[model samples]
Target chain A: MLKIIQRWFIRYSEQDRKLDKAVTGITGRRPYNIRLYRLAMKHSSVAAETVKGFKESNERLEYLGDAVLGAIVAEYLFKRYPFKDEGFLTEIRSRIVNRESLNKLAVKIGLSQLVEFEGRKRSNLSHKSIYGDAMEAFIGAVYLDKGFHFTRRFIIRKLLMQHYDIEAVIETTTNFKSLVIEWAQKLNHKVEFNISETRGSKHNKQFKVDLSVDGEVVATGNGFSKKKAEQDAARKACEALDIP
Target chain B: MLKIIQRWFIRYSEQDRKLDKAVTGITGRRPYNIRLYRLAMKHSSVAAETVKGFKESNERLEYLGDAVLGAIVAEYLFKRYPFKDEGFLTEIRSRIVNRESLNKLAVKIGLSQLVEFEGRKRSNLSHKSIYGDAMEAFIGAVYLDKGFHFTRRFIIRKLLMQHYDIEAVIETTTNFKSLVIEWAQKLNHKVEFNISETRGSKHNKQFKVDLSVDGEVVATGNGFSKKKAEQDAARKACEALDIP
Candidate 1:
């Protein structure tokens, strides 16, 4: 068929073949459309402008991929923890898909090697999430190249099962401050962390934070730094409120 | 053949038939599993507890459906607006899926008729989103019963095409206060609305609100109530900052 020949011609280039091999090394399958994977690797730092004036980058794909990933993960957790409440499922899902976790996952999966970005711009603090963003965009590429069922299989089999240990992911302690803030948002409660006390010397300082919800002091925690103290207080407050 | 007979027997009951008809009316297809639809209609206010100590309600389904609906909508918008940026797509998607909009959509789709809740508890302000919650649960039910491709078609053809005008949905104004708050959350900016002044008589008073983002006053607005004034100020601030 003419269509089959055209497809073969598209994949005949040496550059396309190299991209195909790299993507296959990562995803365990050859990309049907090498163009999607190419775009997925393209970071906004070195985006190409199309003739229509649209800067071609991975952002749009990232947005779509984020949603697909969320849905797949939601269903996965829902089935895995049938007895757990929605809050528990939400908390665990967030732990798995948080920016930091995704960044680590991307690196572990060999995505960092394939991602294309300006070398000079890599040192900027904002580029820390570049790999994670690219990972999501790569997911978008998979979803588009295949379909939802195939994409779901790829995520669960290739990504989650191969890379992540679910039990360890559940046991890992995350930022309690963010947890409590999210809980407060859901319940429409205002949360504030106040530095109640400072003790010890300046070089070896200890900070105490009082965590309040709805103007009521719920818990207090002490740590070596303000951020740590706030996180500690938040953890205690979460326990007191039975957030999860 | 035995499985087909079992399915027929399951749908033979009068109550099952009514529910099947109702669900068919909304989704344009008979559910493969009517039990999921039944659970979808079960509101938490009148939840039934199983022997395993699990409460049978729509909450978990709502969570899953929320993710599925988000993914579907994201893809729909992505393909529809290939030239639009992610921010614009996010804003429009939020406009379509926000609580108030979903509540209205639920009512318009006649989902309110199928949702079951304690009538006495319905008067509570928190029950305002019950219909929307049920709509999402129904989506989850459909996804479970029919799978993703069928559900996507049902949403695009039945829910979106039949009930909503995309142009009108886009043009409809939403709560700017929530929009600004969401934008601030993304950018790690603190937003505050300060009542700058009160004028006119007590019975017919006017409130002036100054909206500030990250400690800088960006805009001010006047209205009959503090909430209204804050919304007005937030709207102006959104325009000033070019947020979507």
Candidate 2:
């Protein structure tokens, strides 16, 4: 009985220490409400519950965090690229907050060691996206605990500046729509994309996008998303016309 | 010369008085940077200028305001609807902040009387969206002058509570996509949308959507936006099939 009691105490203390370390590591301060941080780290697959008996998941926090992150990123981009148009700002923001980018950032911030989820949830959850979700939830928790200004500072100064190469991202990213538009402008040709047909059931429908150059169909592409199909068609048109 | 000078003096004081009234009406506090508020009310067509020699319009401020508004709205929705899924929250947010809604809200706040733009600019600018843009710029100015916490409180308590019927919006606003999905489930039938064909040029393309029910095309719709086209198709399908 004494041995069992000792084991339980050691495990409990270890867990407590780990949580404290994570709070300190992420926020650079002692947490005001450790429960929020704890909830942030708990993935929905674990079915976490609040002290008030409300079923809890990081999903709501993720939503809030996503907005917070967007606002901060938008402000940073707006100030950094004062002369850049809204399209440029939006594209840069997307590149920064995209699932792939966020996933990488979350791992960089040591969330991989801290987040909790059931192994079974791995069936549907991509290994990377869950971490991204958790990162958003963590930001949401930070927003709630310390408020927007502090969260903005944490995201902009601590997370984004520390991890992302903003200049490199701006230089590297290109939109196919812009590429097609530029090509059209240079060649003095008009290009258009129209949805000739839509197929499938409501939610999981497929889009068939046809790209036309100077009133002639140049290429066609298919995707579940219209944007994807449009991009696909543009890429093909680019390849076919040798206008890279 | 004395009469001309007197006229200029009177006009300038009138403009100053109008600005002060506008600020007090919108923010409920005296503005610190009156120039920012003036810039917020200035439309691009008017070609307003700052003392710093930058061509001043509300565009950059609009971008900042959009992000700030989105963050505040997201937080409000997150807290108010704890159990709602991300899609529901997103749809609701879209309803509240859409161009049409914001335009109306801007007018409600008496921005129509205050915002300045050239008559020539009005030819291309849809009367509604310009106000919405100005509203966002106004919010951006508020965020800058007052900080995030104050801006958040203004958005949530002053703007939203005063102007909007939150419960009515939550109850009445139904996404066409969601409506179709629910109808399909009730009838135990499968439905889908597929993009069969696309036409037009790159940026100015139209979407053609065909709604299929039980392996047959029931209705077709065309629109500039995919979502609009889809909603059109869905509504037609709903009407034809008596799927109310």
Model 2, B108-160: lDDT tens digits are: 98876678888834563556688999999999888877778889989998889
* Model 1 agreement with the true structure over A107-192: per-residue lDDT tens digits: 89888777888984455344769999999999999898877988999899988998889888875545688899999999999999
For model 2 the local lDDT of residue B224 reads: 70
lDDT of 2 by residue, A1-244 (tens): 4433443444334665687678778778756666677778888878656643355788878888999999999888988877765656877898999998988888898976678888833463546688999989899889987777788888888987899999888756336767998989998999998887798899978999999998999999777788877886886787798876
- DockQ of candidate 2 against the true complex: 0.33
Top candidate, metric lDDT: 1
Report how far residue B108 has shifted in candidate 1, in Å.
1.7
Query: Residue B238 in candidate 1 has what lDDT?
Result: 83
Docking class of 1: medium
Q: Give per-residue lDDT, candidate 2, residue A108.
A: 91
Give me the displacement of residue A49 in model 2, in angstroms: 7.7
Q: Candidate 2 chain B — worst ten consecutive residues by lDDT sum?
A: B3-12
